[model samples]
Target: MYTKKSTLALILTACLLALLLVAGCAQNNPAGNEAGRPEKQGAVTVTDFIGRQVAVPDNVERIGCLYAFSGHVVAMLGRGGDIVAVVEGLKRDVIMGELCPGIGEALVPASSGAVNVEELLNARPDLVFIRSETAANEGEKAKLEKTGIPYLVVDYRNMKEQMYIVEMIGQAVGEKERALKYNEYYQRCIDRVQERVQNIPLDERVRIYHSINEATRTDARDTLPADWTQVVGAINVSVNEELKFLEDKYFAGLEQILLWDPEVIIVNEAGVADYIMTNTQWSSLSAVKNNKVYQMPIGISRWGHPGSLETPLAILWTAKTLYPDLFSDIDLVAETKYFYREIFNYPISDQLVAQVLSGKGMRAPKGKAN
Candidate 1:
């Protein structure tokens, strides 16, 4: 019994037994498998826009909107009270403050560049909504999974994608009926604009130059800016196939714009409208000469962005601007009031409408308040 070989074997056997016992205990534990991860309970699986199967809670009471755009969609669904966290910048946005007042009180600032893991976890949200691209970040995804909080991804790059995003968000937040109602309303607005503008002859359509930021920067055809022009039955003068894939602003020379000589100029950047109006080089342009240069409306989001909730109103307003004679029967003031009331449940004051139309709360055109 005291042999060296026999003693070594007994020690080995005892160590093996200990390891087996530990393994058995871990397997028996319900908290997780052998890896010690938490178990998901009462989770409903949903396929996101990019086809990722996400396990969301059946009842989502507290929500974190990781993107400002998501906040807009959630507000439209009448679920601003459920939002627990949002980007810091949105809290200070005048348009957001006006549209969803409760967001100011309910949301903690999570992050601007990426999801702040600690801040998000402390918020203790039942679910988080983010853009599809944001979810693709491996580090962020891993962190979110470790916290056991579900995240849903939606895309709003185009009109079809926007509808899909709204529908998906509705399902995630238990606002399916409300989402359907809003979609129906959105479709009708699109139809109304399309029916009137679809038949206008190509040569008869207004030629539009949409300034993206600076006077020389513009959007090309097939972009959101181009889509806005098309929706309003106008021709985008900056139709460059080479710039079609570039999402950011494309640079052009003053001479190029002078050559195009657009009939209307819609400025998305602040103060650029006034700059074009007064610039000596741009004085001879038809848009400038005729006082057809107007600033794009900015409220909860820029009307130029494709997926904005106010896009319908933008289409209506732009159509009115481009073809004042044809759209004479439509009253912009009354429609703006109705849209704000019906969608956001906030009755817009006349002063606020002017501010939004004048792009008062937006970034690019600084220092000039309406």
Candidate 2:
């Protein structure tokens, strides 16, 4: 301890021993080991349509759509490749099959009403998309939670919410840019129609009766079909005391329809239009007498579905159908092609457009056209 050189060497040895002790503590102590390990990345939390917070993986690769509308929106965002599973109805849909044929091979069938936990797990989806109505079920929510796969509730009850749903899905799928592009195009199409029709006086507006199916079920004032009628400056004839509070669609008898005496009848199914045109009882209605009954277009999804992105096209088509002289500048064929090309990135042939408008591409039942 007296010599300088010996003191220096002793100090160096002590420092080495201190270093070894610290390293040993780090290796042996569970707490210290955990502190040294890298932190896991945090999840990205988003508020769903129902205002519920959903914690999703930072990177969502695989997705399962429990609702066909959700699947349709995802496909429109150019992320159809990310879909790992879909409901059997969506997978079997003729328009969907034609639009996203690549998805056919990877579709893991799931039910819209019930969770197929085994099939869902097999699909290896990182997230699932469910309609808000479906997510409200306590049993289904608990079942989905049990799987440990995050799900987001999306509702397309109207156009504003529909746009929001598309944007939300785009963000979830890491395709926000594409979603914005779609919204922009959607707004432009809607604006074009409104700019032309907004000035029409209420009394001058055409009266429209939209039948949901052959059962004579029709849209209420707040439903999508009613929205279409209003957007195009037309009046929904079904908005009476009996149907005003129906919330969605309700069945109407021929007698009730005769009271409305709509000028134009828009049916979701071609067979319904065929029925109306040929039925003697319906001939008294101005729409039937004048042969103004037309079927709504069915594409990848029904245009009448709640919060359908096809609302713009529906508005334009219905407007033209009701007032051909006024909307004559709108070339339906050209507009249909442009819309498919711009929004879906799929070019439509004249034949396909005809099929979509005619209810052929929708795979209507053998005797009934949807």
Candidate 3:
């Protein structure tokens, strides 16, 4: 078989073997790993909040934030620069806008729910983050899948889930270590607050009514406010089953609120506190009579809202508000500055610190204002 055809076949076989070896090496170790060249990374699998396993790219440099909390968590993890696309309202958030100035220039969809796939594809995000509600929509889900882009569903109903969701974002973005560190501080804040307030007896606890936008609209049972109120040893007056208009509804009539006669009224909106204080109908309330109405502080988001990442600070503030003597040493101004600096690595301005502590200049509604 020592012929020219046999000689040609052997040479072709050797060339094919060499090519196969080069291809295998490329798969294991991608090109451009030299000193002057760009480095390509590997893949990592992380389970999202909704229990979906996604293979996320390592060192993800481009992110699309469809969920409201995703951008905040990313910023907290010191990856704000990676955000390439965002949902509406990030630019309007006061703290978020400051923390990540690029948010103002990012590609935003028409709305959180109705994302234009063609527009998003143009942004070239490595991963798209959305809430479970959005992911549940078959149309949106299908559109994302067809594009061959990975997405993570980040949704949480309670405080425990909130912490987990943040960590999950960290995992997706290759910042698991930082996420755990943040959660440690979050837990410590909870432990410190609970240790001081847990001893308060049922009758001794401050009775509170958390007003949302309108005076009558308050927190329902099994909501974020309901949990935090209990955490700070304050009794929420609007947690009654009858007061709930529907499942998870938060509508309490004026008559019902009057019947409860809460000791403290915390309003989330800007001018509602003054309105409740000046209104003749609310004059009979114990909170108004004692002049103990306080506005909830606005930070990265409305601290009292379920969607916010500032719940730890909210708990501390509420505890101090209810019992001044217990948290007398906690200078909220100092704490606010420290929190932003330590967690988000931003040295907060003194003026903004004062504004946040006073809860003033927060005229717009949550998610609609800066």
- In candidate 1, list every pair of residues with a backbone clash: 270-365
**Tens-digit lDDT track of model 1 for 286-333:** 889889999988777777654366777778888888888878998877
Better of 2 and 3 by lDDT: 3
lDDT of each: 0.73, 0.75, 0.81
TM-score per prediction, in order, is 0.78, 0.82, 0.83
Worst 10 residues of 3 by lDDT: 30-39
Q: Candidate 3, which segments miss by more than 4 Å at Cα?
A: 1-41, 110-112, 243-249, 362-370
> How well is each residue in 151-250 modelled by candidate 2, as lDDT tens digits?
9997755677777888888887777888888788778877888898888888999998887755377776555566666788888877653752243447
Among all candidates shown, the one with the greatest lDDT: 3
RMSD of each: 7.9, 13.9, 10.4
Candidate 2, superposed: residue stretches over 4 Å from native: 1-43, 105-109, 244-249, 364-370
Estimate the overall C-alpha local distance difference test score of candidate 1.
0.73
Task: Score residue 319 of candidate 3 by CA lDDT.
Answer: 88
List, residue by residue over 212-287, the lDDT tens digit for candidate 3: 7677888877776788778888998887546656533468878888999999998877788999999999999999
Write down the lDDT that model 3 would get: 0.81
